[model samples]
Target: MRYTSEDVGLLIKTTQYRHHRGLDASLAATGISLVQWSALREIERNPGASMHRLAELSFNSDQAFGTLTARLLRVGLIERFQGPGRVTHHRLTPRGTELLREGRKRVMKVLVLSFASLDEKERDMLGTLLAKLLT
Candidate 1:
């Protein structure tokens, strides 16, 4: 059977959905969604990053980032402080750091399991192709 471009797109979307579902399942025990984990990971990597920058990195709108950060704050996982030019700087709290460490391990386990069937060369090729697609 021949596949059209739409078929390829649908396959990609379905793969993404399945991957995210797996991630969600892995993270459910941690009480944080994948999006929240992504935000926390970004903050950990770029401490004192501005809310705007974090939003951009996370591909979230300002309003969405605001809500996400508020939830993080409520959970005592992160702290935000006003910085120069009224920008809000974000940093992971101690609790956040600890959670991130655990979460990273969990995520790595899931990733390893997901990619277990792909050998190193295939993984490299897939990464290259994905990068090309992004560009």
Candidate 2:
């Protein structure tokens, strides 16, 4: 079996698409999109994370972050509060935390099943390679 440039491109695109699709489907029951889910997860892990920080962490453009924040705000999942010197900070509501915890379990189950074919070493290598791609 040979891997071509097109194959690599497809691999990357499809992997991302499928991951997002799976998460979106699982999160649908929780009334969140994949991006919203991502935002919640990051905020949970990094309490008081700012919109700019979330944008950077998610690799989203300013417009994208703004859009997502609007949606998240509309859903009552997060709230913006004044931080030091009046800077804005994002905090997860109780509902957001519970949703994230439950959605994370579902997402993890999907990911574990998806990666079941890969050996532990392959999974580690994939993680390292993907990190390199990001960097």
Candidate 3:
């Protein structure tokens, strides 16, 4: 194997950061940050999911997710209701659903542009390798 000064791990991290930044920038006009959109998407996926579960799915701490939920509530993007006992569940409001739908379009464009350098086979291979790493 050929040795190089740059670490592959760092390269992967930087690539991910650039991709996230690109997506976030593309979503600026949607009135929600990537983090908020991500939480909304998670809520849509797991309707009636508790805040803790949503936080985990969205890669946020409970407190952070609570703050996010509060903001979304203020903006009327999401609503919360008591489940059983102290547990609370969330759902996307109609506005939230609309924003999420629009955000998907913007994110898709950014992702496509980001991977434009990679051909179909290479993109498939890259996805497989990345999924393997996660596993």
Q: Quick one: best lDDT, which candidate?
A: 3
Where in model 3 is the C-alpha error above 4 Å? 1-6
Instruction: Please write out the lDDT profile of model 3 over residues 1-135, one tens digit for every residue.
Output: 763546767778889899789889988999899999999999999987777899999989999999999999999999888888888888889999999999999999998998999999999999998899889
lDDT of 2 by residue, 53-92 (tens): 8887876876898898787788888888888997788888
lDDT of 1 at 5: 88
Give a tens-digit lDDT track for model 1, residues 7-118: 9789889877877888888888998988899899998887777778888887789899999999999999998888888677888899998888888888889888988999
- Each model's lDDT comes to 0.88, 0.84, 0.91
User: What is the lDDT for 96 in model 3?
Assistant: 97
Query: Among these predicted structures, which one has the highest TM-score?
Result: 3
Is candidate 1 or 3 superior in lDDT? 3
Task: Give the TM-scores of the predictions, in the order they appear.
Answer: 0.89, 0.86, 0.91
Model 2 per-residue lDDT at 135: 100
Model 1 earns a TM-score of 0.89
